[model samples]
Target: MKNYILIICAVMLSQVSSAQTSQTADKKAILSVLKMQRLAWSDNNIEGFMEGYWKNDSLKFYGSNGITYGWENTLERYKQAYPTADHIGTLSFKINDITKITDDAYYVMGEYHLKRNVGNATGIFMIILKKIEGEWKIIADTSS
Candidate 1:
């Protein structure tokens, strides 16, 4: 009986380790998406940068001004704010933390900095990312 119990515990430990490994892989994939967006932003490729976001009418973005709904609307807002490479500037991200809410959801807190010939700006941002159809995408964002 003791030998059987020991075998069961070993199996349970193996399962737990497998789960942790998978979770770590998922986190790396999520971070990769953010890194891709940061590179796209620095390249002044708004469309490419938006590839990280969930392209749906239900998508939401909140900033100091107010809330904006829909992916297209958010994209338009970005165009209006930036307009040209000169305005878009060089972008960088400092991810402070990432918290997994569930297997399908995660939240990221980070700071974004923009360096432009016109001026420079920096702010903190929180984004909620969700895995949909096997792809992770940002569903909501609030930035100051």
Candidate 2:
């Protein structure tokens, strides 16, 4: 009876430990995705930057102009807005927070700064990312 109880407690502890580890890895993966985007943007590679985003029609982006839905539309929006590398400039982010919404989703709040020949721009943004097909992808973004 005592051995059975001990085994049960051990199993529960193992599960908890496994969960914590998995959560930590997932959060790290999310950060990695964002870092990749920053690098891609700074390099003036819009397509590469968009790789962090989900390539689905459901992807949403809300900006000062309005809400844009669909991944292809977002790409068009970016191309029209940025146009040239001078408009893109160098990108950097100050991540304010990354909070888990569920086992498969997280919301990230951050400030973005751009340096370019055109003009420097700064703004805050919040993005929601979800794990899809074992990859973390931004599904929604709201930027000032």
Candidate 3:
């Protein structure tokens, strides 16, 4: 009876430990993706910035103009609209919060600022990141 109880407790403890480890790993992955995005923007590499987004026809982005669908279309729009240094400017981000909705998804709220010679634009963004095929990618984003 003593040995059986000890085995049961060990199994339960292992399971709990695994759960916590998985959660931590997921959080780290999500944050890493966010960091990559900031770096890509700071480099003024529109293509690099697109790396954070899901490369799918269903990916969605919404801006002041309206909703845009598909990853390639969004990239094209960004490229055409912000083609020069005066427009790309210096990018900065303040991550307000990141909440895990599930093992595979997270909701992120953040502020973005672009300092340009012409003018500065600042806005808040809410993004939904989904882990697809063990990789974290932004599935949807909405910004003012």
Candidate 4:
């Protein structure tokens, strides 16, 4: 009976360790997407930055002005707001927390800063992402 209990404990421990490892890998993948976005933004490539978002009509982005729906609409809004390189600015992000909602979804909270010769602005943001087609994509974003 004691041996049976020990074996059960060992199995449970291995499962927990495997789950943790999977979560860590997911977190790293998410962080890589953010890094790609930051680099794209700093380069003033709005299209490249938008690549981080899901390319679906159901996609949503809530910004300081209001909520925008659809990937194309979000891209348009970004273009209207940052029309020139001076406006695009150099961007950076400080991720505070990342929580896995399920095997295919995650929520991320972070702070973003944009520095440009025109001015500098900083704000906090929350993004919900999902694994789609084997890649992580932001499904929704709320930025203030």
Candidate 5:
């Protein structure tokens, strides 16, 4: 009877450890995706930065201008707004939170800073990411 209790405790502990490990890995992968986005943006590579986003037409972006749906539309919007390296600027992020919505999804809240000769810009953003095809992609974004 004592051995049965011990076995149950061991199994529970193992499961908890496994969950923690998976959570940590998922968070790390999510951060990696954001890092890639920052680097690509700072390099004036909007196309590269968009690689972090879901390519599906359902991808959504809500901003001060209004909501923009679909991946291609978002890309065009970015290109139109930035237009040049000076306008694109150097991108950096101050992450406030990364909350797990499920095993395969997370929502990140952060502030973005863009330093440029034209002018500096800062804004807050919340983006939803989901693991698809073993890769994390931003499915929705809201910025102001």
Candidate 6:
């Protein structure tokens, strides 16, 4: 009976450790996704920047103008809005915080700055990211 109890205890401890490791990996994946976005934007590659977003019709984005649905549509909107080097400029992101909502999801709060010929616009972004098929992607985002 003692041996059985020890085996059960070991299993329970392993489960707990696995949970912690999963959470750590989820947080790292989310941060990497954000970093990829910053790099892609800095390169003035809207298509590459879109790689961070979930490639699904249900993906959503909200900004100063309003809400946009669909991953492709969001990419199109970005391309149209920033059509030139002067418009795209350089991008920077300051991630304030990242919180895990569940094993597969996280919430991020960050500040984004874009330097353009017209001027600079700085705003805070709230994002919801999900781990889908071993990849982290932004499912929803809102900024102002």
**Highest-scoring model, lDDT:** 4
Residues 33-134, candidate 1, lDDT per residue (tens digit)?
Answer: 999998999899999999999999999999987999999999999999999998888988999988889988999999999998779989999999999999
Each model's lDDT: 0.93, 0.96, 0.90, 0.97, 0.96, 0.90
Model 2 C-alpha lDDT per residue in residues 39-91, reported as the tens digit of each score: 99999999999999999999999999999999999999999999999999999
lDDT of 6 by residue, 1-144 (tens): 999999999999999999889888888878888788888898988899999999999999998889999999999889888898788888999899988898788999999999988688789999999889989899999988
- Which candidate comes out best when scored by TM-score? 4
- Per-residue C-alpha lDDT of model 5 across residues 1-144, encoded as one tens digit per residue: 999999999999999999999989998999999999999999989999999999999999999999999999999999999999999999999999999999899999999999999999999999999999999999999999
Give RMSD (Å) of candidate 3 vs. truth: 2.2
Let me know the TM-score candidate 4 reaches against the reference structure: 0.98
Candidate 5 to truth, TM? 0.97
- lDDT digits (tens) for residues 1-144 of candidate 3: 999999999999999999888878887888888788878877888899899999999999999889999999999988987888788888888889888798789899999999988799899999999989879999999988
Better of 3 and 5 by lDDT: 5
Model 3 has an lDDT value of 0.90
**Residue 79 shift from truth in candidate 4, angstroms:** 0.4
Which residue window of length 10 is worst by lDDT in model 4? 114-123
List the candidate 3 regions with Cα displacement exceeding 4 Å. Answer: 1-17
Q: Candidate 2 at residue 50, lDDT?
A: 96
Model 2: residues with Cα > 4 Å off, grouped in runs: 1-8
lDDT of 4 by residue, 42-141 (tens): 9999999999999999999999899999999999999999999999899999999999999999999999999987899899999999999999999999
**Candidate 2 lDDT:** 0.96
TM-score order of candidates, best first? 4, 5, 1, 2, 6, 3
